[model samples]
Target: MTGPGMLTALWLTPLIGALLVVVLPSGARRAARPLALATSLLVLGLAVALTVGFDPGGDTHQFVETRPWIPAFGATYSLGVDGIALVLVLLTAGLMPLLLLAGWHDADGSAPSDEGEHDGGEHDGKRDRKKDDDEVGAAGRRAQVYPALMLATQALALVAFTSLDVLLFYVAFEAMLIPLYFLIGGFGGRVSDGVDRAAAAVRFLIYNLLGGLVMLAAVIGLYVLTARAGLGAGGAGTFDYRIITAAIGDGRLEIPPGVALLLFAGFTLAFAIKAPLWPFHTWLPGAAVAATPASAVLMMAVVDKVGTFAMLRYSLPLFPDAASTAAPVLVTLAVISIVYGGVMAIAQTDLLRLIAYASISHFGFIVLGVFARTEQSAAGSALYMVNHGIATAALFLVAAFLVRRRGTREIGRFGGVQQVAPVLAGVFLVAGLATLSLPGLAPFVSEFLVFVGTFGPYPVAAVLATSTFVLAAIYILWTYQRVMGGPVAPGLEGTPDLGLRERVVVLPLVGALLVLGFYPQPALDVIEPAVAHTVELVGGVR
Candidate 1:
C-alpha cells in the first residue's frame, strides 16, 4: 500500500476521468455527469483505502513515489504524504464526490426568468435574441466541461499535497486557477444578481498569477543556492524537497540571513495571497460568490486549503530561521484578518459575500495556529483545515439552496423561513453554529486548540483573535434571524424544504460536522506527529 502505484492512483484516477469526460461524444454527452460522479466516487474510494493503509507512527512520508521529471533541471516527479499532508489529501479527496453532487445541475439549462422577456418575442431587438441564444447554447457544452474542470482541480490539488519536489508542487499550485476561473465566470451563482462574474474570474487569475510569479523567482534562487552548496550529488542542484529540508534541518546547509528572508518572503507572500490574508483577500469574496455553490466550496474548502497547507509544508520547513523571525509579523496580519473579516462579514448585505468574508476570518485562525509553532498550535492548524472544509461546505451550500428557492441573496429580503422550510432553516443554523465554532461542534475543538496553543507565546495576539468569536456569533445569528426567523418574508410563503437531492447534498456534511465535533481525536492523532516534526525543524532554525 505504501508504494508508487497507490499514491499515483490518487491523482491519476481523476486526471484520466477528466480526459474521459472531455472526449465524450455528443451522443454520449448525457452520460457525462454520471461518469464524472462515478470517477469522483472512485477517487474517494482510493483515498479511503490510502488512508487506511497510511501508518501514522511509521515513516514521515508514506506511499512514497519518485521518478525523474526533468533531469537537467534537477527536478523529480516525486509524491508522498506525511501525517499533515495525509490529512489535507484526505480532505481534498473526501470533498470532491460531494462537490460534484452539490453542483449536480449547475451545468444544466437555466430555467426561464420570471421577467416577461419572451413576450417581446420576434418584435424583440437583435441584442435580446442573441443573448437568449447564447444562454441556450452555453448549457450542453458547459455541462461537459463543468465536471471535467472539477476533476482536473481535484487532481492538481492531490498532486500538490503529495509532491516532494518544489517544482512539482509549484506547477500544481498554479495550474489549479484555470478550472476555477472558468467555474466562476461561466457557472456563477449569479453573484449580487449576476454582476461582474467575468471581472471576478479575471481578478482571481491575475491575483494568484502574481503571487506564483514571485514564488517562481524564489524557487530559482533556492535551487541555485543548493547547487552552489553542492547539496546535490556531484554538485548538481536538486529540487528534491527531502534533500533540502534535511540539509536545512541539520547544520549541513546554512542560508545567509538576508537571502533567507527574501526567499521566505517570496514563498509566504504566495501562500498569503492564496490563503488570501487581508489586503490580498479582495479577490476571494467575488470568486466565492460568483462560482456556483459547489465550485465555491471547492475553491474555499479544498483549493484554498492548499495555500495554508503549503505554509506548513513548504514555508516553515524550507526557510525555518526566516519564519521564526517573521512569526510576529505574520501573526499580527492573521489577527488583522480575523478582526477585519469579522467586521466586514457583519456589514455584508450579500449572503455569499458574508460567508466568504467569514472564511477569511477562519483562515486567520488557521494561520495563527501554524505560525504559533508549538506542537499544540501546529496540530490545531492541521485539524482546523479539515474541520473548516466541512463547516464551510455545509454552511455555504445550505445558503445556496435557500437563495435558490428565494431567487435572491440579499439578506434583507427574507424572514421567518423556519415556518415554511424548517429543515432548511434548522440545518442552516447548525452549519452557521459550526462556522462560529460553537462549543461541542468540530470547529470549536480546532479553534480552541489554536487559542490555547498561541496564548503561551503570543498572549496579546491570542486575546485579540478572540474577538472573532463574538463577531462570528453576531453575523451567524443575525443572518439566521433575518433570513429564517420572525414572520415569513414576501414571496417565501410556500417555500419548499430540502428536496431529496438537496438533502443528499447537505445531510452528510451536517453529520460530519457533528461527528467530528463530538470526537475529533482520531484526526488529531494523525496530525500531531507530523506537526511535531515540523516544529522541531523550525525550533532548531538558529
Candidate 2:
C-alpha cells in the first residue's frame, strides 16, 4: 500500500534490522551482514513501489504524514516527498545493497588469505610476512559493528531527506553524525599513524556539530520571530515550515535586514560545511581516504547530498532576498571548488582520496546549479545529486575490489591491471568516464542542464566552471592509464578478475547510469514540478 506511512517504513526497516543485529549473540554476529542486506533490499523495493505510485504531475508533496511531535514548539513528526526527495530516496536505497556486498569481506573481519603467495626466492618471505600482518589486523575488527552502523546511517539519511518540519530536519541532520562518527572511527582502511580513525572521526564530528549548533540558534530565532509576528499566536512559535515560508514569501513576517542576513548565514554555513565547499572541505579527503570503500560510498554518495539538498530546500526558499544578495559570492566559491577539487584530484596518488576530491568538484556543480536560480538548473541540481551517487558508488565499489586484491590504495602500487583483470578494468573505465561526464552517461545529462541553465543568467560564472570538464578528463583518464596500463605489476599477475559477487555489486550501478544517460526524461519529469514550486516560492518573495 502506497500510504503516508510508507516513508517511515522505508527508513525504519533498516533501523529495525540494526536493532536486531545488536541483540544477536556474539557467535551469530556474522548474520548481521545478510540481515542488513535483506533489510536494505526490502527498503529498495518499497522505494521503487513508492516511485511507481508517486504522481509526477503534481506540484505538492505526496504521501505526507504529520503528527504532533512537540506541540509546545509546533514541531511535528511530519514526513513527505516531492520529486526531489523521491529521487534522492531512490538513490539512497539503491546504493545500500551494493555497498553491503562490496564490503562483505571487510565488514566480516576477513583479510585475503596467503594461500597462493608468490614464490620468488628472495621476496617470498617478506610478502608472506606482510600478508600475515594484514590478516591479524583485519581480525581485530568487530564484524557486527560496521554493518549495523551502515544500516543506522541509511535510516537517518532517509529521515533527513523526507522530513518537512525544519526542526525535525535539523534533528535528523545532527543525529546522522553519531552513526557516521562511529563508522568512520571504528571501521575503515588505515591512514598514516598520526591521523588515526579516531582523529578523523573527531574532526568530522566537531565540524558538523559546530554547524549544527549554529543552525539550531537560527531555527530558534526564526521561531521567536514568527511568534512575535503573531504568525502562530496560540502556541509556541511555529516551526511549521509552510507557515514560516508563507509568512516570509508574502512579506508578512518582517525580518530586519540584519537579522535575515544572520539567519541566512547560519543556514548557509551549515550546508556549506556539509556540502564541504572549498575551505571547509579539509576534513573530507582524510576521512574518505581512510574509510573503507563501503563507508566512503555512504558518506560521500548519500550523506553529503543532504548539504546541497538543504541549500535548495530551505536556504533559498526561506530567505530569498538574502540568497539573492549572496548568490554571487556563493557562485564564486562554487567555481573555485570546481577548479580546486579537480586540480587536487589530479595530484592524488591514492585512489580513494582521488575519488574524494572528484566528489568535491562534482558537489561544486550541484551547488552552482542550486544558486543559479533557474528551473533547469534547479532540476539539474536535483538530478545531479542522484546521478553522482550512482556514479561515485560504482567507482568506490570497483576500487574496493582492486584494493581487496592488492591490499593497497596507492595508485602507484599497480600497473597494467587490465592484463590481469580485463573485466574489472572495463568496469573501472566506465565509472571513471561517468565521473568525467561522458556523453550518454547519466552525469552528462544533468551537467549539461546545469551549464545551459546557469549560462543564460551567469554567463561568466558558467564559463569559468566549464573548465572543470577539462580538469576532470585529465584526472580521471590519467589515473586510469596509470593504474590500468603498461606491463602488469610483478606481483599482480595472479590477481583475480571480478568474481560473481563483485559483478553483482557493480552491474546495477552501470545499468542505471546507461539507462539514465539515454533517457533522463523520467527523472526530469519528476524533478521539474518540484523545481517549479521552489522557483515559485522564491519568486513570491522577489
Instruction: Specify the highest-TM-score model's number.
Output: 1
Collision count of model 1: 1
- What is the lDDT for 437 in model 2? 97
TM-score against native, each model: 0.95, 0.93
Q: Per-residue lDDT for 322-433 in model 1, tens only?
A: 9989999999999999999999999999998999999999999999999888888888889999999999999999999998888888999999999999999999999999
Per-residue CA lDDT of model 2 for 68-148, tens digit only, reads 888777788888999999999999999999998888867554532324455666667789788767665455335666788
Error of 1 at 481 (Å): 0.8
RMSD of 1: 2.8
Provide the RMSD of all predictions against the true structure, rounded to 1 decimal. 2.8, 5.0
Pairing residues by index, what is the TM-score of model 2?
0.93
lDDT of each: 0.89, 0.87
User: Which window of 10 residues has the lowest lDDT sum in candidate 2?
Assistant: 109-118
Number of clashes recorded per candidate: 1, 0
